[model samples]
Target chain A: MLCGAGRDRDVLTQQLQRLGIVPVVVDAMSEPVAQEPCDLVFIDVDVGRHSPALGGGVDIPQDRPVLALIGSDVPSAVEWVIEQGACGYLVKPIRGTGILASLVIACHVFEERTTSTRTISELRHRLKARQLVCSAAIRIIDVFGIGEDEAFHVLKIGSMERRTTVEDLAAMIVSGELSVQALGSDVEARRLRV
Target chain B: MKSVVPIGILFSTQGPYGTVSRAMRDGAMLALEEVNADDRFDFRLEPHVQDPEGVPAAYLSCAQRLLREEGIKHVVGCYTSSSRKEIIPSFEKHDALLWYPSHYEGFETNDNVIYTGAAPNHHVLPLMDYVLRHVGRDIYCVGSNYVWAWENHRIVRELTQVSGGRILGERYLQVHDCDVDRIIDEILDRRPSFVLNMLIGESSYAFYRAFAEARRSHEALHDTVIGSCTLCEPELAEIGASACGGHLSSSVYFSTVETRVNQAFRDAYRRRFGERAVPCADAEASYNTVHLLARALTGTTPSEIEAVKRSLYGVAFAAPQGQVSVDSENNHSFLVPRLGVSRSDGTFDIVRESAEPVRPDPYLVWVDGTGVWASWNGRRRELTNRPRLRVIR
Candidate 1:
């Protein structure tokens, strides 16, 4: 927890202890804490913004889940926390009551957000790969004078023959590492072998 | 000379959920009358009543008119969560406080609204405990397709899973849809230990009557019982005599709570609305809402929403459901949870009750810990008996 020593921190620490969560409190002025080892990071938005230890601003690690401790609901304060990629927030003057809730909800929301982010990235990669496959298939069509389905079949056969993924073979064909002509010849050679 | 405070009263007295809403309105009216007569406060509450007729759209318009045209700062209304959700934006936009008085599936806290009802932890958690202890683990869920049903069922499912129990069957019917024969047939086929009835208003009444009839014919269903958190005394009357008794309900207040304050409240309610208008949990909460509002407005100006809200925090009332208070943190009430069984005469027999008011955990963060289920006094350990996996091959 990167927070200044105060009632909010004390109350939060006590509550966390009660919930069986061992909160390792790190003062904002202390040496930079290794965030990679931590499961969850709770940063005080107000303090972290001014703290030199946090590099004068809260640098929320992308891999770790963050929960913001906010003292003010002003748009700027909230916006700052949101920009920091905090999954959840606890309003300042933290009471013992909402700590568990904030923690649970924050973790759950963070997991969902992380999953969605990962899914989107994976989908984008696949989309690019699909474009490459399409480009390779079109090149095969242009070079060999075959139908679109037959071009895709030839690519599939070439990938199988090369012992590579269809996407990898498509990339290889698109990059001109394995030319479309070579792919067509490979498909023919594989058919003759069969 | 008493100052007249125009209080907005929004309820649907003529729709699918009208019976309970009528009772709620009556409860508010009763408290309004009491507050006006008491002379404890210098201001007299004048109710500017509007019936939305259970239409979701009408709630916003009615709430808007109340807050804008009527210039009412405090309103005690809303039976369904959807209606409450619809008008909340209007309340927030107008900077008015909506004194919502109905137990709902929680997970909400708004500065513009004071929830004077049982939160999920205060209602469903205790009910689940009772069901798992006395009733059966295999649950068959049937609810109206709405947020209230969905959220409550989610809690039930979570608790059931944590306890190593099973949800045998689940179904969601449209609001006010009474085509429950198919659901009943499915329940008969599954033969669940208990039916978790999340259906509201007319749909609930229809299910009760139909299920009762089905139970009479099916010997397998004789042991199976219907359980609900929304079932109240007025709804019990609607369910009719033969089907009403033996059903379990979890609530903050029941008309049959044998307390001096409750008895007096019941007597006054009967005197005001006559024998037909029964006081249920929502009615009691509505009654409590008005009283709380009156208390908050004792010396404060009605137009100042912030002052009224500030005054409302941590205010305790000798409510029909014991000493209920507003949680300073979450505007929800700290209410005593009670488990009751419906009687033939349209009242609940209190089976179990908390020793004191349980703090309202709207998000259920406290009741359910970081993990899906927290240790609840070793009850989870006692209840969980997982079947061991064996190699069939």
Candidate 2:
């Protein structure tokens, strides 16, 4: 838990111990530090103005759940904590009863959000790759007169011979690193007898 | 030569939750007077009373005037959690003690305040056990929109969830909001086996009357009892005889406790405040606070906050409720928990009582089995592994 040294931190530690969780306390005000290995990171939002996450210093892993320990219910404090990507919050003074509940709920929610974000990022990468491959296939059609399917087939053969992914081969062709006409020469040599 | 100490009495006797606060003030004053008359101490307690009138903002001003301007160290007051919270920073700032005498949704333990009341474990948890055992599992919670209501409902929700029960509906209204007929009608329609009421003052009284009036036609609603950890005699009177009966209240004290100590307390209260002055849970708690303060002040200098706090440790008062004592570690009282059914005469019929005064678990470490010992003593102690057995309430 990234919290200042005080009663709130002590209370939170005690509460965590009661829930069978012994938290690794971090100095929130000290030099910028990465998130310690833990199920949840409780950030003291008020003291964390210089936190790495805010200044884009150290990236907190998406899977690591962050629960902000907020004292004031002011709009700015709440908005800033939310902006820092806090999954949930434990209201300050760190009362005994709600700590465990917040941990359970916040971790569950963070995991769900993390999973969906990873899925979306993966899908976007794949879509970009497919678009690159399509662009490379079109380049093949323009450089060497061939139908759409024939152009795609030539790109696939080059990708296999190069022993690289189709997306990497497409990037090479798109960037003019590999000439489509030179690749078309290989296809012509193979089809010479026919 | 007797030492004279001026004490501050901060109670809201005019605002939204004033009916109960009036009774609480009366109780505090009654104890103060008794302490002055008693020869057990060579000291006199002079009370300077201030009425916050139920406004949360007023509490800060009143408390500041009492603590800073009036120069009083030990002030006994506050009814609602919000009011107490408002005044706490002032008490801490002045290095004074606030003898907060009321049963609340207990999650705090500040050295500046001594809580001489039922914690959630003492009241709400037991009430939940009773309601879950006798009453059906499905509950509808209706409360006043405040910390007390929110925290108590949270406790109820946790216990109910643990016991494999469900909350059918939960609702909240403003402290003075009286438009509860719709909520009552909805409660009747849902027909949960019980209603856990956390409403205070006018809203609470309104709920009882509206629920009673609605139940008059709806016969099936007879089985549905409204259980509250906050309700007591003064509130019952405000609720009136017509609507008071059939409600279950869990408190540390009710006027109907069949003990000589209670009888003496009731008699003294009637004699000093008149017959109309009824004692409720908070009233008893306020009375306990004054008595506890007087005992703590017997030897210690009034200005020494640390001395007074140390003197409070291990001291027990034969309060109207029973033996009331502050836990040395947490500053919350260990008192008996009693469940009562409201009688038509603005009194409770004591139905269930803990065999002994249960230790105050203000942070609810034991009740929730959080197993986390709140190291108020500066060292992490071994956790108590007391398994919560199902007690037949």
Candidate 3:
């Protein structure tokens, strides 16, 4: 937890200890402790804005969930916390009542966010791979003088023969690393071998 | 001279959900009269009643007119969450306070509104706990398609999942839609241990009647009971004699509670609105709201919204439901939760009740640790355990 040395930290640490979570309190001005293998990070938004390290462009690890300790509801203070990618927050004068709730919400929200982010990135990669496959198929259609389905079939055959993914073979074809004529030959060779 | 304060009363009283709203309005009116009659306070409340007729848009207009034109600062009304949400901005803009008096799916804390209703922790959580402990966990949910149903069902779904139970089926109908034969057929087909009914007003009454008819024919459905958090006395009467009994409802206030305070309340309500207008949870909350408002505005002007709100916080009233008080942090009431079984007389027989008023957790942040959050995190572990394999071979 990145917080200024004060009563808030003391209360938060005590409460966290009661919940069976060990509190590793870090000063706000210190560098982002990316080496620390922590499940969650609690950053004080009030102290975060004034920190030379956080304000001077330190990247808080996006993989771990961040929970903001918010005392003020002002837009700037809250917006800064949002920019830090806080998944949940606890209102200041850090009491024990809401700590478990905040932790639960933070973990739930963070898991959701991480899942969606992973899905989006996976979708983006698939889309790019799909475009490559399409481009490779189109190139095969032009070079081998075949229909779209037949061209895709030829690519599939070549991928199977080469023991590579269809996407990988498509990337190779699209990048002009392997000629469509060579892939057609490979397909013919495989069919003859079979 | 007693200072007169104009307070706005906004309720539908003539729409799909009119039965409950009428009772709520009467409850507020009764409290207003009591406040006016009581010599203990220095101020007398004059109620300016407006029936929004259950339309969401009308609530905004009615609330605007009350706050802007009539210059009323405090309004005791809104039974549906949609109506409350609709007019909240108007209250904020006009610097007025809305005393919402209905048990709702929580997760809101607007500065411009004082929620006298049972928050999810005060109603749904307690009810869910009771049902899971005593009854079986396999539930089929049917509700009106809205936020209240959606949020409450979400809680039920999460809680059920955490407890290693399954939701057999879930369905939703439009707010006023009463075609429940298909849902009844589905319920009969699924044969869940219990049906969680989140349908409101007419839709709810129709479902109860239709389900009762289905149960008469199908022996399997006889044990498949219907449970709801929004069920009340007036609604049971609407469902009629054939279907009214044997249903379960969780509420903060049921007219059948055996207490001296409740006995007086029921007698006065019967005398004023007659036996037809049976007091329910919403009515009791509205009664509490008005009394709290009157106490808060004893010496201060209602126009000072901040002072009135400040005074309103932590205000306690010996309400019909028991000693109800406002939580200073959330502006929601610390209400006692009760689980009741409906009888043929259109009143609930109290099955279980909290020993004291439970503090309102509007966000469910405190009470929901073992519910959605736990289930979500549990799912996370399951996801991690499943081996992520690639088609390398």
Candidate 2 lDDT over A1-194, as tens digits, reads: 76767667888988888889978876644434464666677787655633242232233445578888875443345666777788889876577878878888888988899889999998887688998899999988887777787777777778888898778899998888987777966567445733
DockQ-based CAPRI category assigned to the predicted complex of candidate 2? incorrect
DockQ score of each predicted structure, in the order shown: 0.02, 0.04, 0.02
Candidate 2 similarity to native, TM-score:
0.70
Name model 3 segments beyond 4 Å from true: A1-194, B275-277, B369-393
> Between prediction 1 and prediction 2, which has the larger DockQ?
2
> What global local distance difference test value does model 1 have?
0.80
- Model 3, position A44: C-alpha lDDT score: 74
Q: How much is the lDDT of residue B370 in candidate 1?
A: 22
- For model 3 the TM-score comes to 0.67
C-alpha displacement of B12 in model 1, angstroms? 0.3
Interface RMSD, every prediction, one decimal place? 16.4, 12.0, 15.5
What is each predicted model's overall lDDT from 0 to 1? Answer: 0.80, 0.78, 0.79
lDDT tens digits, residue span A92-166, model 1: 657788888888988899899989999999888878799899999899889877778778888888888789878
Model 2, B1-393: lDDT tens digits are: 778999999998998889889988998998899889998889999999999888777888999999889899999999887677667777888999999888877767888999888887888887787677666789999887656765677677777888898999878787788899878878878888889998888988898888878777787776777888878888877878878886788888889887899998888888888877677788888888999999988778899989988888958888777788889889998888877778777887676776567789887776663211221121221211211110101
Model 2 gets an lDDT of: 0.78
